[model samples]
Structure formats: structure tokens, C-alpha cells
Target: MTNPPEKTPENPWGPQNSSPEQPFGQQPVQGQPAADPYGQPQYGQPQQPAADPYGQPQYGQPQQPAADPYGQPQYGQPAAQDPNAMANPYAQQGNGQPGYGQMAYGPTPALTSWIKRVGSHLIDWAPITIINRITDPMIGGYDYASKTERVGTNPTLGFILLVVGFAWFIWNMVFKDGKTGVSLGRQVLGIQLVNADTGQPVGAGKAFLRQIAHILDTISCLIGYLFPLWDSRRQTFADKICNTLVIDTK
Candidate 1:
């Protein structure tokens, strides 16, 4: 019946053979450049610069070599490469809290300071505790009053005691090793002088420096001793300048 009205071929083979469901000449989504070489999208607006690990840029992207806008470490350099970077970014170091190092918190109160002060009035008792046998003969034999009293007797006795005590103070401070390396008063209080860096006994050279500074400490009649109450490190001005600490031995 008229060659079945010019039938199409049973095989699919031409542009006319294509399915109308999909359009021609379009790329599959997998082939399009949806991401940059570093796996970030080239956003619609102008792309801001970014750094790559190897300090080079992917094609079509600007190179940011040195630093980021945030100013942290860039591409391949260590943050600590500069020595200043290792310094504490915060200013509150050694503030009696846990610092980065192993320096523990400083000495705490054993007894109330007034108790120590009252007890200090009787500190002449301590030399007896140091040695069971008397090193000085007069300490053991209590012959109560000498012929010369300070009030009614020889002025020479007072002068001799003053001169000898001052001389002994100078001599001992110039050559000793311990907390009281600087003073008998500090020693009787169960303290020891130590270096700021090493926290161990310092030498005579440093002690001399402290002794010179003691002029300032003594000029005001030991008003300087009250400094540790207000100072952040619990140090007097002399202790600060001499780079020392007075630690408790008790």
C-alpha cells in the first residue's frame, strides 16, 4: 500500500536519529572547570589572592607570597623563624601564676606576718638552737649585768658594742653564703638569698652589689622592708636591682 507510506529505517543512524530529549554540543558537567587547580571555586566576583603551600599560584589566580590579611604564618615558613615570635605575646609573664616555664608559684604564708614579727622580737634565742654547746663563753654563763651599763656606767661599753657590731655586720656580709648572706636579721628570719636566674647562692660580687644598695634600704631605717608587700614579685628595690630573691628556709 504505496511502500507503507515511505517508512523510516529500522536502524538509528543520523542527526534525525538523535533523541530530542537532550540538546547537542553541550559538555557533560564533569568536563567543565567548576573548581580552580587548588580545589576552590573561581567565584563570580573578582577572586582575592590565596597562598599555596609551595609558594606558587595556580593559573588565573593572584599570588599572595608573604602573608595573609590576618598576618599569620604564610605558605611555607615556620612562625618561630623570627626570634621575636618566641617572645611572650602577652605582657603578664612571671606574674605568680603558671608561666610557660617550670617556675612554680612563690613562697606562701606559713604564719601571719604579725606572728613572725612578734616572734622576731625574741630572735636572739636562735643562736642557741644552732649549736648545742656554746661557741661564745658569755652566752652560756649568765652573769646578768656587767660593771658598765649603758645608762649609768661607761660610755665606752656602748661605743665598743656599736663599733664591733657594725664591723661584724660589714665583714660577714662581705663574705658569707646563705640566706643571711646579706644580714643577720634576714638569717634569723629563716631566709636565704638566691640568684634570680639560678635561684642558688650568689657570690660575693653580687652580694656586694646588694650591700651597696642596702644604703638606700637602711637610709630610711628599713622602711624598704615593707616594699615586698606592694611589689609584684615580693621584692624590695635592692632585691630587684641585684637580681635576687629571698626564699624561706623553713
Candidate 2:
């Protein structure tokens, strides 16, 4: 068979000159991307810099740039700030002398001498006094629980009352749904007992301790319990011995 004919060059860009034989006057490795003077992607596109929503510039640290002669923001910067206003929006400040130690000065309450607080509902459990003919059905004074009747009643009735009273107080101060002091009664009465210093609710533990200390209040035939009769805040001896206070939870 005859060999195929050899191709002849046609133009100056052909192999007849120094140019290599390739399609369309191209060179080898033609797929590489073009580089710029600085060797970055270019075409009127710019390198992006981050910015805050208000177009303010931010850095790792707060800016303390030189101020203008008129004490305003530099020509291209944001608005100036007032020193008397809030410097940091999140920083906490208060109305007090600027120092590490802040002192609260005011008149202490005049009634500080009386610390014990009790619910008015305790009156419900107390022996009620009868004056008129006694009519109310829920707590009619004609019953044995009436104060006048209970006061001069037979010794047996008084003994039973003493038992009931102790039980009532004991149940009130401790052992009620992990809380102390006639829970529902006090809740309905809009009162609560708390530690004086911590301002926390009185719990079963403290209630138990307080109940055990009632012996001191009963020292003089429980005459001290009635001492609140003469005192201003009406706190009994047991209340003072314990560092507790009753407050209007409502």
C-alpha cells in the first residue's frame, strides 16, 4: 500500500516558521488560568472586608483613634460619643459613689426590734371569746372550743386543749408537704415564714428545730407567750429565740 501524503504548512504561523504545529496558533498547557500583576483574582472585583450593620468598622479591641480638633469623629469615622452617657451598653452602673465599696445609707425600720411574723390565721386556732349570745355556726362560741367556756372549764377539757394546742403548733411548724407552719392556712392567710438573714422559705428542718426550742418559751408557765400582749409587734418569746421572721408573702 502507498504511504499517506505528508501535510504542507499553509501560513507564517505554521510549522514552516518557528511556531509549533498545534490547533489555532496555541501552545502546550493552554488550560492554565491567567495571573494578574499582584497574582490575585481580578476583573474590577475587589477583596471583601467585613463590616458591622451600621457600616462602622470593628477590630479585636475598641478603637481610640485620634479625635478631630473640634472633638468630633474623625472625617471618615462614626459619630462622637458623650462621656457622661453610657460607655458600654452592657456594663452595669448604679447611683452610688464610684468605688469598690458601696454603702447603703437610710433609716433602719423602727420596728426592727420585733422580728417574728405570724399569720392572722393562727387566730382561727386560738380559743375564741364570746360576748353576745353567740350565733356564728362555723365558730359559734357556745361550743366547748369557745374561749370563755374553755377558760373556766373542767380540768379534763383544759388537758385535752393543751394536747390539741401542742399538736396544732407542732403540725404547723414542721412536717407539712416538706414545708413548715400550717402550710395551707398560712397560704390562704397571705403569709409565709422565712429565715431572717437569707430571706428563704422555712423548711422542715428549721421548723423541727424551732419546735424543739418552744420549751424555753414555756419556761414560766407559758407566761412569756402572752408577752406579745404588751409588746409592739406582738412576737412571742419563741419567735425571738429563733432568727426567723414572718412576712406578707402575698
Against the reference, the lDDT scores of all candidates come to: 0.56, 0.53
TM-scores, one per candidate: 0.35, 0.33
| lDDT (Cα, tens digit) per residue for candidate 2, span 147-169 | 45322324455445556655655
Off by over 4 Å in 2: 1-172, 177-182, 230-233
Residue 185 lDDT, candidate 1, scale 0-100: 50
| TM-score for candidate 2, residues paired by index | 0.33
Best by TM-score: 1
Compose the digit string of candidate 1's lDDT tens values, residues 1-250: 5655677767343243334343444333543454455756555657665666777777886755755666578657776455555666444566646555555556652322433432442453244343323222323334357743233244455455445655554456656643334345545676566777776677877787876786776687876666766666666677888887766667
True-structure lDDT of candidate 2:
0.53
Best-performing candidate as measured by lDDT: 1
lDDT of 2 at 213: 68
